[model samples]
Target chain A: MNEKPLELIHGEIDGRISATEREELRALLDADPKLREIRSELQKLAESFEKVQPLDPPAGLRARILTAIRPPEKPAGLAGWFPAWPMPTALRYGGAVAFGAAAAVVALQLGGVGQGTPGMDVTGLAGTMARYQEPGPAGDISAIQLNLNELHGTITSHLGEGLVILDIDLTTTRPVAIVADYDSGRLRFSGYAQTDDSAMSVTNNDHQIIVNHEGPQHYAVFFEGDAKDSVEINFRFVADGQQLHEETLKIPLVN
Target chain B: MDTDNELELVRRCQKGDGHAFEVLVGRYEKPIFNVAFRMLGNYDDAADVAQVAFMKAFENLARYNPAYKFYSWIYRIAINEAIDQLNRRKRNTELDEARLPDWHTPEQAVRDTQLSAVMQEALMDVKTDYRTVIVLKHFMDCSYEEISGILDIPVKTVKSRLFTARQLLKDRLADTGLL
Candidate 1:
């Protein structure tokens, strides 16, 4: 009897052997009663384990697990949307004023009250304003840098009133588009506004807002609106419509 | 449960159906709890690990790949949590033996429980990796392929580990005259 094929018996008993191996094992066992005896012993060992009972989980375990997975309790009122970080003194007061002013401006523009605000068309303007207009009751800015190759910048954003405004300070030698990837239906590209720069234009699809800049420039861009708790922005430095440098910033939903 | 059924439940969960996820929790809670119980040798710690594993699974469901069985993916989480619990317990001087609750009552049940306890004692002597494969195969009834996917090990490695583990268990049980 070949002893090497003995391993096949173990695998066969465990249901881990292949079909061809099963045929081989059957032939080996039929020609050898000793191999049959070994198989029976292995089967008894496996059966002995079957006598071991599985313990029942605690009655409350299912409930406890479900409770833990239940979406975290949404923060109450405006407090739910913002991080619980202490706000800077200037931002505390200035943010509230800016938010009020921005909201009023957006409400007016949407109501067709301001036809030529130059930089208030992006739907995110109202959100941007709300984000920084008033000091958030809580939470810190979840920010990421736009550092990819020749580009360098910083983006700081906070959540409030169901929106976030990306306060982006970017300096790049190549023309770059600062894109905000908002969750579908959760966030809207309300509006866009940029500080004095070489040249800038904003366009958007359903999922993202693309800001195109021309030549070397330093600018602070504000993109906002919609009710998403988080946003992911990608900085794509482009030359002749081809992407040269790309970096991504992921902002988690605070709520 | 069929992977297709689980895939449907997972799709519902991905679409934000908390109730569907709760059904999944009910389905998996026992096996996951058992895995932790056998690994940690205590009820409270196992329960804690099981709860954490389910929560982690739900929170990270978006990252779950659909190509693998959901049980394999979730079992991996439970095993990791169990191993981590064991490591944490090792750091402390005293084991919380009190945390193991008693369930035996009838005479036959009592004998079985005692036998199980001896078996578990022998299991504790096995290394964690070996112990894991053994438990997955014998106690959890996981196929070798399932074990491979759950532990992220090659099939040959799984076979080798099981062989070593079975030998060790057989030796330990026989030494105690319980085999």
Candidate 2:
């Protein structure tokens, strides 16, 4: 069979043919009775497909699906979801962003990513922008999940562009201050910022940072994770000047 | 939902919002299940594959690219799952070719059963690659471009696959005295 007419036949049946192509198809059918037969057969084929009945999935399938995801499946070593980690190829070329002074820090606060969906107490995600646009190294990903009553989210460490980016996505019931203390010997503090427009104030004094904010917020803190062994950072969660909890994180600087 | 809302739901899901994931599942489960039914031809297998597809989608939400439609991404997952199931069936049965599908349903009108059975057989006769295009185009009501996106193939490849699939279906139907 002539490929062009066959192509046009499918296009016309699919309702994808332009006026010019439809006219071309008509001429082809006129030139050969076999092409007309093929076109007729295809039209009927489509009509038959229209009669394919849709069946309902078995009962309880939705429940089963949601149950499978209640814990949110993760890879073998990680316990939570991390956002916008780069592909290995892209990560290989990632230029780590490093700062001159300070080291790694972990600041605990009450906040969710961008939304405070009830029943789940984890800061969702700060919306990792697409990977190609963000520079990140091809290295290990470490994440910690928090299910605190006041704050729910994940703090994730990603190696990229020669810097360790700690992503904090969370929601807070009240105003919370995140106090972070880092050793200057193992790492360098690059920067920190909230990912979206929410009221926030941050204070840093070389060895410590105190961030005060309220509601759902997402942010990133970058540090030079170039230490030979690992980096540890201490965090103090404070609400209205009272400490709520404390956490310390040790990240192997293995990039 | 609009594209903006859909993207927002996806974003929320990535952020660990179970509600957002449920909303997405509610919106797409029916069509995805139907696509699975058409591809696999067994209601039970279709249900299993559809459920697994959504599970995989949830597990990999973080790696999803926002540049494409969320439905496209999920559809691609569901279709790929269906194909994988088909391959496993082949390996277990050691069949040289796919058997005629049993598409019977208790709710189906008796009048339509013969035609539906014939349609199922014709569908199973086509190769998986072509069967996928047919399911996306005819069952899922997708455009050629949408089909291309779901299959991760060029539009040209989609057209060729659709054409071949239709030709195969038409020839089979003719053999069965349906056309």
Candidate 3:
């Protein structure tokens, strides 16, 4: 038999040889003791290299990440069930003052009146403002309360120059708090959550919103606007001392 | 899962589906983590680097081409991340010269808890270029062509580096009376 190529044999041992070369190398290895010895040595080293066990990640690493990527749970009460009303383009771009003023005008045009219901009373302009002020003092503003029964949904709005959206749909229920500050043209947002007694938070100050949640909940918040401009919005929610669920709306105004 | 199913998962993940990405993570975490841990001697650092690499890969999934192997792409990312981490550690003076022991005897290594750890220590002491070639060839069991694609190096360079790494390892092992 022709002498086997040592390089080809080495390549085969190292998994570098081509198929045809591999076949040739294997045949030669089957016949040669010395070549087999070298191959065995290389194989041992390679096997040893592959046997190292990877260390487990830090206990909280996975939870920390999941918290960051997961969405938040809807606030408990009426707001949870209310469909997220998209902020009007004028309100999102024109500034909070402008948006509020526009909203006032729209409210006036739409009769600027409050209607009452059996479960809750929502009557009179004063009552409407009161509901906006207290949110659920009479437990009548059930629409603004988040439903704990269904924990899957997204809330979207335009904050400053960009859109702001939050997604809350996961098996785990973690209270999430989002705060947005459009004080400047830039938007800032922060998210916080707690999982298994551990708390995690992520903040994007530029976007003016903070997302805070606990557990395996999933959520998202986005902001867009030019730097050096400012807007203001109100975020409201109640927590059981352990967590908070709040949302802030930035109303733009042209000074 | 089937390759077609895996491809679908990748597509869903690229479309910003976190659940889909999570599925992908579950499927490849072990293999990816193994590669990183082998390439990097420390388990903690390897795990951190692997997680970060996977997150980064997911974030940039839009840039991934379906035509290439997903495993290769992820492996490349993990390798690059590990190398970058090593460079950062060197710059920060975090890598201690004292931490690296002289090569051990092959018999000593064999009698040790696991020869992998000894080999790992030896590999860590080598130059980054040589170390990577050795890892791709031995630990990952990658073909020269596959290594070439992942590292963007020519096949000849892969061959030369592999030969150099193996020769150096052999010399070091022999000197330690471990061969």
Candidate 4:
């Protein structure tokens, strides 16, 4: 077969040949048995291409993404009585101003400084204690604050021992615990709150606390002994919960 | 329900409405992910690339000219992202070595597992550039023009690539005496 005829046959199999070209190739195939065989081979190859199906993605990818884009806790159930309005308008602008003012007031009280010093520095030591005590109108302690000093660290109460921390350092929201186990050393660290109640413990030579969840969450290092003097736990908040946040502290062993 | 509704959703999404975008994403997510998987040959990479493409499309919805079809715009983004992922994998030696088995039979009574195995091996033997075009054309059933648009290649280039892809497949199969 000539180069042009072979190319035409390929084009026909690929659905790329013009109508006239297809006609020509069809005629040639009808006239020659050998060319017909060549056409069959090309057809098989094309059909084989169709056999490969697209596989499903590994599970958990979608949930991780949706969680990432979720907004701050405005309200839930009957508490969300405010009007839902479209963005880029007067209502959005007004909402933004209102939110800014409320944030400023909270910042000032926590920062331990006057309103003149760039609002409230509601972070570090001052904000940690305030956030722990005040559970907000939502009746949920959205997050916990940890005071990691050079030698010692303080974990604010309200984050119970059984609760697991899935993430830390989230903006304006606390981390949710999907699982918890204290015996296995799976403890919710400072700077986050637990949401889920799932927990497990494994008693091997070295007891391991395994907190299983469908998604990523915060965790802290712990030792297997009641003697706290030999164990030092370091914790940090993560941005996406997958990446560790820059701010971190080591909880010194209480000897 | 139709293209008009889809376009309306897109318009709503462009105005910073997340719900509308989520709806649009829900509608096209499966097909887009399938296309990405076929192009990239890896499930994890395809999912990541598809998600990124949707997010990018959402972020730049205003820049999307209304004259073009929505699928065309979104698909263009997906194809480019898939190709970029393929290239990045090649550079990083992160190409998923996991091979997907095929399911084809000659008797047409039951799918031939053996044939599927042979076909998968044959496909892996072909170069990535050729395999991508073949998958888009045959598996996805994209028209030549659509393929050309997605890949950002001329119509003639699409033809040439498809032709070469077929030739490579035939040669591989013939070597295995599967022809």
Q: By TM-score, how accurate is candidate 2?
A: 0.55
Instruction: Summarize candidate 3's per-residue lDDT along B1-179 as a digit string, tens digits.
Output: 37678789889876666677777776767666666766766544565566666656765788988887787788899899888767755863522232224322233245345455557667777898898888777766778888998999999899878877876776666555556
**Best candidate according to DockQ:** 2
What lDDT score goes with residue A67 in model 2? Answer: 39
> How would you encode candidate 1's per-residue C-alpha lDDT over A1-255 as one tens digit per residue?
554466787687687789999998899889889888767756655776787888887544664454334433345643344322222333322322233233333222221112344443443322111121223334546666666665676666655433455655666666555555556455544333333323343444445555554444332333334443556766555555556666676667654
lDDT against the true structure, per candidate, is: 0.62, 0.65, 0.50, 0.48
Give all TM-scores, in the order shown.
Answer: 0.52, 0.55, 0.50, 0.55
DockQ (Cα-based) for each candidate: 0.16, 0.23, 0.07, 0.16
For model 2, residues B45-111, the per-residue Cα lDDT tens digits are 6766776788778878999999999999999999988888787668646221222223333333353
**lDDT per residue (tens digit) for residues A64-127 in model 2:** 3553354333432322222223223222111111110111111122232223433112232112
Put down candidate 4 lDDT per residue, A122-180, tens digits, no spaces.
22111100011122234322234543221122232121122222223212233321112
lDDT of 3 by residue, A173-237 (tens): 54534344344334323222111222222333332333344445433332333434434454433
Better of 2 and 4 by DockQ: 2
Ranked by lDDT, the better of candidates 1 and 2 is 2
**Which candidate comes out best when scored by lDDT?**
2
lDDT of 4 at B26: 71
Per-residue lDDT of model 1, residues B47-67, tens digit only: 667877876787678999999
Which residue ranges in model 4 land beyond 4 Å of their true spot? A14-23, A68-165, A168-255, B94-125, B176-179
Model 1 chain A: worst 10 consecutive residues (lDDT sum):
A125-134
Q: TM-score of model 1 relative to the true fold?
A: 0.52
